[model samples]
Target chain A: MRLLFTVILAASLSLSGCAGTQQKTLYDKLGGEAGVDKIVTHLVQNIGRDQQVFHYFAEANVKRFKKHLAWHLCDISDGPCDYTGDSMKQIHDGMQINERDFNHLVDLLIDAMYKADVSHRVQNQLLARLVPLRQDIIYR
Target chain B: MWKKLCILLPLLAPLSIEAADGKLIATPGVSQIEGAAGGGLVPWAQLAGYASRDEIAVNAFASRGSVDDYSLDVFGAQLNLYDRLELSIAEQEFKVDALNLNIRQRVLGSKLRLYGDIVYSRWPQLSVGLQYKQLDDALVANLLGAEDDSGTDYYIAASKLHLGAIGGLNWLWNVTGRYTEANQIGLLGFGADGEGYEWMLEASTAVLFGRHLAVGVEYRQKPDNLGPKEQDWKSAFVAWMPNKYVNLTAGYIDLGEIAGSDDQDGLYFSIMGTF
Candidate 1:
């Protein structure tokens, strides 16, 4: 058992070591503006196909959403882009988003990141930043 | 065994519906011994299965453990409704090898999520739960000088998952406060000569390696309400979730003393199927 724990600990350390010195920002790791654009496109496509949360986006403008989402991602990842979109609270004020729908959207976002070839570490970094915004977006 | 299979079949029949997979993979946690969604021994704040607020989920599990002088088999089922409330029922059969006898107990549990989400909400998830347990036969408990054949355990638990908080891996932790007087988790029954309810603390912490595997440790404080010293319990466990539909868990437990048997260490294994 001791050996097993040691191996697990070592494996986790090595895997986390992939972050490797933090010389690059999460935006760079996500391939900069081009990568954010791809991820947003994929997320929009996922929402388009999803039955659980598609209704929330049914009346939304696809092009504006794609642009704002990309900008949001870029800004949150410490990129050089200014987020010209509305505040999370302002945008989702009356949507009456429940926890389930909010989480579904997060799952879609993860899928989008994975499809954009983001590493797990980068994904987690981005997610950590986004987590605090859940309050502003959900149940409002 | 055939009867067990018969019960498991209908639970498996709903697998084709393709609903209740709304929650993230492995977020709901495995089944606890008392049929709650938690670690091997401690119940967590999360509910059972991956069902979200818009869906319903059902789960069934069986677990077995053997110590120096005793063995236990437990089978249970859980229903998670709308991600708000959970109901569970479990039956435990304990084999006392030294005395060549068996002790049976039934537990009915309910939990309600009071606030927050484990991963998303700024605050930790909080839940309140109750477990009503009854020993099928109170003969052994009476011999052990227990006060009652049935008891109830009430607890409030808080849990949270930190994204990449530990070495770029997810880390989850839970703390619970329980009010109970059950001796040996009610196997030897409830209370003692003049004892009543007492507050006990339980805690569990785990590190998730990706979305599939988790390694954790749990500590549960016990009440020595009977003749024998009811020592505390602790375990180190590993849980593997291949997908949303199945989970497997194995652990090494140190149940310090049980009905005067000291250092009752053992291995435990469990499997659960979700729908």
Candidate 2:
């Protein structure tokens, strides 16, 4: 009985140490910029075809928008992307936008990300980073 | 005295039992998203994040107010994940009478609370989300041949509960920031002439006055999309919840615009049901 108890204690200790070592940081799980770039590309492509929102971007340079969007996502996620686009406030000034419009845009982006097979955890992380912009985007 | 002790004993005993059991027995507040034991009529600036004590909920809404004269319909779904995060998707259909346009759009987003309680508990909650929108090309082409309406928006929000010293009334306050890049409507034309990005800031608060009743107010400031300008709005509302499955909300909204042509006020109503 004494020998058995000693063996059990040693096994539990080893298991706990292994568990600690297996923990992974969010940055590692996200696959870094490469993963974010793929997700951004998917999102831009999806938006470009969406008629409901496309009217707003009819004149937008898609290539430029894509590059800026990718960099913005990286910067927001605490990664390394420098964004040179206009400030959000400077860009959206004018046409009377509302909460309904904003919500519609959110739905499409989520669908695009889903189609890209972005992991739910990474999606949640990205969403959390984006929530603060409600004030800046929903004018009326 | 014996009768009084009997009455008191029953109440006091339960309190002690609850304490021993480690079950919080305070009056329940609204659940994070799906109408728990609290009120539902008030609008929370913070997305539900992922507090899923309840199950999934789906809601459909339609409204016509004094300001726009257009009929709007909204459909939405909310899900709680891992009892800590809330994900929601919503779509809006706008029928513009003046513009002779019918536009439909969809937004899919998720919110996760980094910390805090959505209901009954007293921790601060933080959330983030992203949205994409697309316009129907036929509608855009019909309304404005050269115009497109598609883009992405992102947001982050934080909320805290304040239990006032007077009568311990429950109060919730939240702040959110949003970044948007999309096209706006032109007065004389459509398309690239009215496109830009915007940064918005908003704040809201609600106070609980009775069981399943709350009143609140919200304010938001955003950029003008037509020209070099900006605009703001304010709203006041009341919420009522009779149970944990249904919610009713009504409010008044006001918007400020340039040249006074877009200034308007209207009433809004919404119903939410959770399974």
Candidate 3:
């Protein structure tokens, strides 16, 4: 148990040290526009291949989704971009996306971030910005 | 019991391996001592495995807790159906060194999700569960003036997970209200000669670091119905999930007093496998 304690202590210390180096904005840390675009592309590709959530995207316009989602990510991450797309509730109002699919999308996003070589710290920052939008997008 | 688990686990594994692994890793909590998906000692609202609504899940766990005057070992299995209902069975062995007695008990448990989701829903997830316990040997309980050798515990639990809520890490919490008549979680028996049931509140809080590790604390209120002054159970735990299939937990436990023994505190360890 003491070993476990030390491990957690060490991990937390390293994480805090990482935090101490957070002078860069989340957008800058996400590799700015290019990295965000890469992550969004991977997320869309993952969703296209996802068996559980693909049906929800089947009737949708892939090009439009990719653009708007990228814009949304950038807008939320304090990037110098503004999303002119519809509100989250407006776009997902009748989709009736449940918790399962929502979380599946989040999982895909995490994978996307990983593929883009985003650090866990930066990934969490992006997720923190996106999670609040869940209320507007689920079970509408 | 270990031999039995060795056989039963392999048999159970194949069935769940074919089931859909819909939920994400580390979302489903570890099995509690009573076989419910939860923290070390308190049952949370989450089910036992990573099954989503369209899948079924099976899990097995073993736990041991040793204190100043006694030790407890538990072996349990759980079946989760469609991410909504949970069924579980657990066997407990309580060894009292002071009395040189080995007491055994069996627990059968079921839980049904009542509302929401732990992560994505607007509100926290909620569930109701029941644990029916029977003492294998009634000698110690009867001698302690317990009313019955068997009893049932009913509880309602609410659980929530907040993404990046604390220091950019996930935070989880569970609150449970249980109405039970058992003493020493049914090893010492149920109720008193005149008493019936009491409501006990239990709580657990945890923070997820990265995706694999969780650190938490739990408190479980106890009912005192016998000569021994029963105290609440408290613990600080760390759970590591290397993947969806396995979780290992270690903790320091404070069990207070038991059967006239005071300051009963020690260590706990558990391992759970989900298929």
Whose TM-score is greatest here?
A: 1
| Each candidate's DockQ | 0.44, 0.01, 0.33
Off by over 4 Å in 1: A1-21, B15-18
Model 3 scores a C-alpha lDDT of 0.87
Q: How many angstroms is residue B102 displaced in model 3 relative to the true structure, after the best TM-score fit? A: 2.0
Clashing pairs in 1: none
Give a tens-digit lDDT track for model 3, residues B1-275.
67877988878767864754667678788989888999989999998898777678888999999998899999999989989999999999999997898999999999999997787667899999999999999999999889999999999999998876655677789999999999989999999988889999999888787889989888899998898799999989989999878899999999988988999999999999888
DockQ, cand. 3: 0.33
Each prediction's RMSD to truth? 2.6, 25.8, 3.5
Per-structure clash totals for the candidates: 0, 74, 0
lDDT of 1 by residue, A34-101 (tens): 88898998898899999989999999999988888888888988899888779999999999998778
State in Å the error of residue B2, model 2: 58
What is the Å distance of residue B199 in model 3 from its true position? 1.6
